[model samples]
Every structure is written in structure tokens, then in C-alpha cells.
Target: MTQTGTASKTVFGVPVPVALFFIAMMLPTAVSVNLGGLRLSAYRVVLLVMILPMLLDLVSGRRGRAHVFDFLVLAHCGWALLALINWGGVAQGIESGGIYIVEFAGAYLLGRLYIRSYEDFAAMARAYVGLVLTTLVFTVPEALTAIHILHDGISGAVGGPMAPYIEPRMGIERTFGPFDHPILYGVFSASSFSLAYFVIAKRQLMNFSGMAKVVGVVLATFMSASGGPYLVLMMQGFVCAWQRVLGDVQGRWAALFSLFALAYIAIDLFSTKSPFHVFVNNFTFSRESAYNRILIFEFGSAEVARYPLFGIGLGDWVRPVWMSDSMDNFWLVTAVRYGLPALFLLLALLIGLVWTVGQRKNLPPEWRRARHAWAFTLFGITVAAATVHLWNALFVLFLFLIGAGAWLLDAKPDPKKGRMTQASFKLPFRPAARLF
Candidate 1:
């Protein structure tokens, strides 16, 4: 899709975004990825997750300017077909493939919606940073009140309810930093600061106060005990800021993102910081959580064997209640459930996007920073997935950032041209199509 007048794109008759949204909404209900720690589900629901994102493209008329991001959807589509006939082991493969689709599409859709413009992308980054800051400040108290801290449900005793905060691990209770879980907190925080750091290093953030705000956000993410998410996101941020934002700047913004990352690690390592109470209190591996996805995939191999290709049918993974409680690594899970071919297809789709976004010529310095920020943000998401689900609200913020960055690149030259003036519709994306 090359960007033009709004026209409803669809296959048969369903709007892709809408359909996928429904499937995501239904996924948990139809089949819990965690079946009381058994980690087995009905495969049919998984299929819906796979096919849904594609519908987004089919319905977008394929000529829409934002088609570059749509490449991800294509990857999922390939996974779907591969799963369908997965080396003739179709059943288990389809279900697993379906599940991954839900996770991937959820993140992508948010990117399409919120990141529709440079301003929106920047706003999302700021907001995420703000969230991290808020959590950092709030966690101080949560950390202070020993008894009230661990003996709780939602979180925040002296303050208000933090709907998205979570502390899955025992010792260092990662305060959702902002969205859902510690890992998610890590993902969101990493993406948030990565963008902020890029902007600052490249001078795109502008002004001393804004730069300070960006730093504050990055610092907050550090304090929250997110583990792996914290480490990886920092590296991705560094690479992006250096290549995309800095261009040829000496030791300034070019390496700013990395510096922040290093500083964060240094503080965490040297400081007497600890989850403190959680460390003294309960500590269980919770092997059933995101940490044990590998186990789940191992068990799923047999299930896939039953349906080598084409899958058990076309649905979520249906474990007969007695299945083991283990989650698969995204790569293996895709193959065992959908087939090896589907996994390859999925990778191709993502790699293609990486190639397209990585190419840029003589963009203005500021625009260049913005571009690198989004590109790095996308790559970072890919890396972050290894540890946690990418769809959590925290990481989804990056999706918005990328969209905004793209919008900035393609923004209308004339203020009045191609822009909707009405507050009722002109926000972004489907303003023309949304009016219906």
C-alpha cells in the first residue's frame, strides 16, 4: 500500500484490524496459554491469531503508504501456511503458530495506530518515560513499607492502584515499571529510553529540560528489577542512536544511548539496591511463567508430530488436559506447532522489514534521528521477545513511536493539505476511513 485516499481493505468482507483485535481479545478466553501451569490449549484459537493480522493488510487496500510495517503481517502469513502443511505435521504446528501470531500482531497493531506521526511517536516515548519515572518514585515507598509491600494483590498501599504493575520474581520485584510485568516493564522501559536517548544524542530531543526528562525515564527503568529486558534493550538503544541519530558525531549523541545504558548497569551493580523484602520473603522459580517457555515447546513436539503438516486442523493448540506445563521458545514453538517452514517464513517477513527500514539517504539531521529511533525501536522489540511477550502495553508504546516517526517522514508539506482539521476525526491513521 502506497498511501492514498481511504478505502476499506478486506478479504471477503472483514476489516483486518478489527478481526485481529477480536481474535486477540478472544485468545485468552478460548485457550489460556497457561492452563493452570499445564501450558496446553485448544489449537483452533491460535489459528485466528495467525490469520487476523493479514486481514489488516487485505483490508487496507495494500496501496496504503504504511505498507512497510505490513511486511510483518506477511511474515505471520507465511508462518500460517507453513503451519497448515508443516512438513505434514499440521495439528500441533498450527496451534503453536496461531499463538505466536497473536503475540506479534498485538504489538504491530499498536504500532500502526499510535505511531502514525512523529509527534505521536515522541509523545508516546515521553509518556512511557514518565511512567518509568512515576514507578521509580512510587516504588521507593513500596520498597519502604516492608509488610504492606509483599503481602498485597494489585500494589501501592499508601498511594493509589497501579493496574499494570507486577512483581513476578521473588527477590527483586520488578514494579511493572509502567505496563504489565517486570519483563514487560523492561521491554517498555528499554524501548522508551532507547527512543528518548536517540533523540537526546542526536539533538532531536532539544532543550536542556527535555534532555533531563529523557534521562529521568531511562533511570527509572534501571531501578525496576526487570533482569534480561533491562540489559538487552540498552544495547539495542546504543546501536540505534549511534548509527541512525549520531551519523558521524564524535562522542556525543552518537554514543549517548550506550552511555546511558552503561550508567544504568553501573548504578544497579554498585548500589546496595535489591528487591530487599522480596529477597527476604518468598522465592519460587514459578517455572510456569515466561522463564520456562522452553519447557513448553519441548512438550509440544509430540503434539506437532501428530499433524506434521496442515496442522491438527486450523485452530489453537488443543492439549488433552494432561499436557505438560511448558512454553516453547518462539522459534521452536512456531516450528513444532506450525512446522519448520512457517518459522522460516515468519523470520523472512521480519528480516525484510529490517532491510527496508534500515535504508535511508540524505534525511535532515533531526529526521534522521527520528528514523533511527524507530528502526532501533523495532529491532529492539524483536530482541526483547526472547524473554517476554511483546504485546504488553509497555512495549506496545514503541509501536506507537515507530508509526509517529514514519508519519513525520511522510508528513504533509502544506499544513492544510492532506490533513483533517476536525478534532472529531483527523487524529491519524483511518481518519478518512474512521468517519464511517
Candidate 2:
């Protein structure tokens, strides 16, 4: 029995498979080895491997309540296949689409299956913290030497360069360590800042250890040296400040968001320069570097209009010759690649997750706190997605959170019993079918 009262088999309070999953997720590249022509990433491989338990449960006839988001995820995958087909070749489509199916579908299903309780959510959060800490082992050295240790080995293992150490930006080489990019490392580090603080806020971690972990995450974000992550950090700080200063944040958050959206629209309509150009020019000192992103939106709008239904195809957008095919914005990118319906589904999924957080009055105290924090975190990610493509490790990490949120939303504590029974697979049926 664990904190959530589910019968958990664990080596040291943490379930063995869950622990292995976290290790695989956290050390995807570090544990990776090249086999002939294939570079086997531990993270990707482990995510697939983790499917075994769920399959076994399915074979054993475990079923739970299905949420709207579940269908949306599957639908998203279907759209992905269609988009890949739009790309041109059936073989290439399967090859490209298969990985995505693994990540979006596989990760989501894994989360829904395993992370069925708050205790599981908490364990995963701790594992995320562990993962972040582990990266510093390599990131610190890379930062000091201006060299990435994982670069040569990972590339050689993959049979090609996977994460080439790039030239320094602003005279400082960003340290990504084992991650694919510095921006990804930075965004991931900044993303975890809120989760780390959540543990402290809940009084889960204490004294020197907790403070040190928080400080380490802060430093990691700084070492990333990317503007996007810096913005995410600032957004998180603002969210925290909003919660502190205001007695309740919902009303004020909505008002502020509305005002900002309106202001952005107003600027885009009235100003000679579009809002994207204006924002890039004013918000970032490296205006030249951000020009491509601004162009993505500027050109992406036309692309969105062109393929309002099913998109032109995955990775097959007609961009200005000067502009690369990169659609940096998640909403725009999804709209362009998978079509508007897919984009709408993505938005529905995100909004639904946040909305689920506050929909109930009977939420456990712990879940109540999670509701507020996750709402802000989701908002921050949405903002960050505008600047970077969302198909990175950060998205994978976020999928787990979404699964947790779904669990919280669907679960209701028993009033008479005074606690919820842990949903488990019994011989013939799932015990938590009603709760689901």
C-alpha cells in the first residue's frame, strides 16, 4: 500500500518499473548506444518497452473510464498518419509517423495506464527532479570546457551526428550536455523549476536538500542561455508572483490574458509592422536571430489559410524561399502540419487539462494545489511553444503531467469510506471502472 492506498509493489517505496521508466526517460541519450546503422536511444526504447505492462493488463482485462482526452490523443495520431501520407511516400510516412506514434500515443497511453493516482504523479515528479540533477553531471563539465562530451559518442552511436556542439552564442557556449539542443535543455530546466518549487510549497522536500535542488534547477536554467527558456522562467516567476500577490488568481489571470491578447491583436491590425516583428524586435536583443520565428508566424498565417482543412502535408509547407521549413510555433505548426482540426484538438486537449484542474469542488487538498500550479505551467508552456517547436523532450515530459491531470479529474474520493480505493487489476475486471 502506498500513500494513495493502491497496492504497490516497490523495491524502496518506488515501483520498480516506474523507477526504470524514469531512468530511461531521464537518460535517453546518455544510456544510448550505437548498433551498426541504428542509434538506439534509451528514452525512446524504454518508452516503447514500458508498453508491455499496459498490454499485459489489457490482456488480463483491466478497463477504466475513458476520458475525452484519450480519444483526442488517438485521433491526433490518426491525423499524424494522414499528414505523413501527405508528405509523399508510404514507406517514408510509416518510418516518420511511427516515431511520433510512439511518442504522442505511446507516452500518453503509458501515463494513463501507470499514473492513475496522485502518489504516482508525485513519484514521477520526483523522478523528473532526479533526471534534471543527473544531467548536471555532464552539463557542468560541458559548461566548463565549452565542449559536449555526449556529442561525439551519441553521434557515432547513431551512425550520424545527433547533437553537434554548436558555436557559442554571444561569446558563450550553451551547455546542453546530452540533450539534442541547448534551447531544449534550457526549456526543460526552466519547465522543471515550477515542479521543484511545488514540492517545497507542499512541504514535501525539506531543509538543505530541497533548497539545493531548487538552486540547482535555477542555475541549470541560467546555463542554458536561451531566450525562450528565459522567457519561460520569467513567465513562471510572474505566475508565482500572481498567486502570492492576489488572494485568488483565476479572475485576474483571465483579465490579464484577455488584455494581452487584445493588445497583440490591436498592434497587429494597426501598426505598420506586424505584431510578430514588433514583438521580436522589442522582446529580444537578438532581433536578427529571432527574425526566422517571426517569419514563421508571418508566413504561417498564409499557410494556415491555404490548408484550413487537412494540411498540405507533414514537413511539406510552401515557405518563402528565404524562410526555412521550420514552423516554430506549436499552434501554427500543428495547424499547418496536421490541419486546423488537429490544431483544434490540440488546443482542446490543453485547455481541457487545465479546465479539469478546477472543475471539481471535492478535489483532495494536494490536487487543489496541483490545479493552480499546473494551470500556470500549462499557460507557460503554451507561451514557450510559440517560440520553439513542441516535438522535443519537454513535450514528452509534459505528456506525463497531462496523464496525471486526467487521473485527478476523473477520480473522486469516496465520502462514506473517507478514501478512494486504489484502482487495480483484479482477476476479471478493473476495480476502478466506475471512477474512471
Candidate 3:
């Protein structure tokens, strides 16, 4: 799939950029390799590989264009740096805040530069389907035998501490499946399920392969056995129905706001607790964990009121030695860590990305497939992340989703000339004819 006389050459079958993107996205986080006496996770190494070409492109005066969302993401990082600076000294900001920016913001930049068109995006989708299928092979064995082959095997090689395995819950041993936690594993698969289905629905994937991908993602989700992922999958169904039955996009938003209002009113009338506390208490599988989360949210809310503008820098805001490890909700973590301004910037990034993709009506039919795929992917992940702490690989993956949506939103289609416009590009492989 080479563009003649261009740098987009194929490597081992896939285009070079697409291959690097695929490796960076799909390489198992449970694995790592050492280079020059330094140990690094597989994803870090793959990201370095992806970044190398981008750096070369910059040197060659072929640096990719930036979008508005890039600045919004940067603002989120800038706020995070300020928070870290307030919490600790410059060293902490440089180490933690800088790394956060590189992991989250860098992922979006890499995605925007590499995945410039729908064809590149589809190649990534195909690679994602492959990842789902491959993960299933390990998960199925782990589900039945209670053996984490990938985790156990890679632990020795990585020479770093791995997340400890927990006992089975609700008669299911939550499968790690190459992710740090079962919840993340589930959210990752469930997100792929929605994204793959969106692509399939748009006829981007061959019938058989698309169906197989859907089946594979479903199996992986169930293997994760996390309530959060199940909720995310359910939300995808709700969103699909909301889009179909509930008028249009605006109508869906109205309905969502109405539901939130009703839930808030119900919480006020029925209990002496906040809606978030009431909602998570019933939604979570582990009552103990859920209670702690409620306490965290309660304590974090107080911290927000006290430091509404700038926020009380990190340290142990949540009391009790047991629960002080973290605040589970991604939104809460951002608010408590970086203050309300940072949280607002993050919200703007997510909402703006989704709105730009979902509201676009001028995209080509093929490009439209990617638009919907990314919209639902972000929506599902947003819902999932609300209840979970997104760190490491998952946070990077989320930023990649935002970057993809931003790229698609800025793209323009040239249906008349059949040329690559700022919005659309010609496919390297004929999607209609390809089976895999």
C-alpha cells in the first residue's frame, strides 16, 4: 500500500506509518524490553519508534499540521504542570507533569501526524480488531485455567513490579489480558467493540471479518468481568438507541441532561448523599470499594470548595490509610489533582472533540465511517473513565482517540475531483473488495 514516489512505503505488508501506529497502539503493556541498560515498557519503546519518524519529518520540513484541539490538550497539560509545581517543586513537575504531558498529549500529536486520513485510520482499526482477537486467545486460557500467561511471563522480563493478581469475584476471575487491571482490560475491549461495530456498520470492514471482530471484542469484555466495562457497553447500546429513536444529536443531549436532572432530584429526595455517591454505591460490584469511592468523592468535593480556583495540591486529600491511594473517578482525580480549571480544560477537550466529530455533515461516506467510529469510541470511553482511574497506557489511548477525532473533524472531502482534500483521501486498499 505504497503511494508512488512518496515516503508512505509499506513495511512487512502495512504502510510504514500505519505499521508504527499499529505497533504503538496494540503492543501488550504487560511486556517490556531493555535497551542500553534501561528497562522500558513495550508501548514506550513503540511510541519512541513512532516518534522517531515524526522527528525526521520535522527536520525534513514535512511536519504535520496542528489543529485547535492540539492547543486545548496542551492547555490541559499546562494546567497539570502548574498543579504539580504547586504540590511539589520543579523536580516533581518535570518528572510527573512532564511525563503526563508526554504520555497523554504526545499520543494525540502522534495520532494526528500519523493518522492523517481515513485510510490510515482504517488500518489502525483493522489492527485494533487484530488486537482484540489476539487478546482473546490469552484471555480465554486465563479465564479457564486462572493463569495469566502474558502477565506472569512478562514480569520476569520487565524486572519491575506488576499489578498483583486478585481473587475471582462474583464467580469470575477477572482476566488481566495484557492490561494493568481487569477494568481497563474490559474498557479497552468494550471500546474496541463499539468502534469495530461502527466501522462494520459503515461497511468499512469485510462482512466476515467485521463480524469476527465484534464477536472477539464481546468475548474479551466478558472475560474482563468488570462492572465498569459492562456499564460502558450498555451505554453504547443506549447511545445507539438514543441516536436512532430520540430524534437527533441535539435531542440526545437534551435527553441526557434530563436524565441527569431527574437522577439528581431523586438523590435529593430519597437520600442524604450526593448523586455521585448514590449512583456509584448501587452500580459497583464491590460494596466496600464503592463505599470508599463515595468517601473519596465526598472528601474531594470539600477540597474543591476550599481551593475552588487553584486547588490544594496533591498529597493525601482522601483520609484513611487504606483509601488514600487514589480517587477512583477520572474527573475527580483531575479536579483534585489539578484544580477546577484543569478539569474544565479536560472537559473542553473531550466535549469539543466529540461534538466536532458527531456534528460534521460534510464528510465523505467513507470518511463518515471513521467519524462515527471515533465518536462512539470516545463516548464509550468517557463513560467508562468516569468510574476508573486512567493512567499509563489507558490514558494515552484516550488521548489518541481525541487526536483521531480532531483530525477527522478538520478533514474536508473532494467528491468532485476524487482527490485528497484536507478532509478526505483515497484509500490505499479497496475496502469494498478486501476480506481482511
In order, candidate lDDTs are 0.46, 0.66, 0.68
* Model 2 quality (TM-score): 0.82
lDDT ranking from best to worst?
3, 2, 1
Q: Tens-digit lDDT track for model 2 on 88-144?
A: 578777766766767776666666666656556666666666677777887877777
Q: Which regions of candidate 3 deviate over 4 angstroms?
A: 4-18, 21-40, 46-64, 160-163, 201-209, 244-273, 309-314, 415-420, 423-436
lDDT of 2: 0.66
Candidate 1 all-Cα RMSD: 11.5
lDDT for each residue of candidate 3 in 80-181, tens digit (9 for 90 to 100): 888888888887665667666666666776666556556656766777667777888888888888887666656646564565778786676788876778
Better of 1 and 2 by lDDT: 2
Question: What order do candidates take by TM-score, descending?
Answer: 3, 2, 1
Which is the leading candidate under lDDT? 3
Kindly indicate the candidate among 1 and 3 with the higher TM-score. Answer: 3
TM-score of each: 0.55, 0.82, 0.83
lDDT of 1 by residue, 118-181 (tens): 4334544554455555555655454344222321332344243444345534454455422334
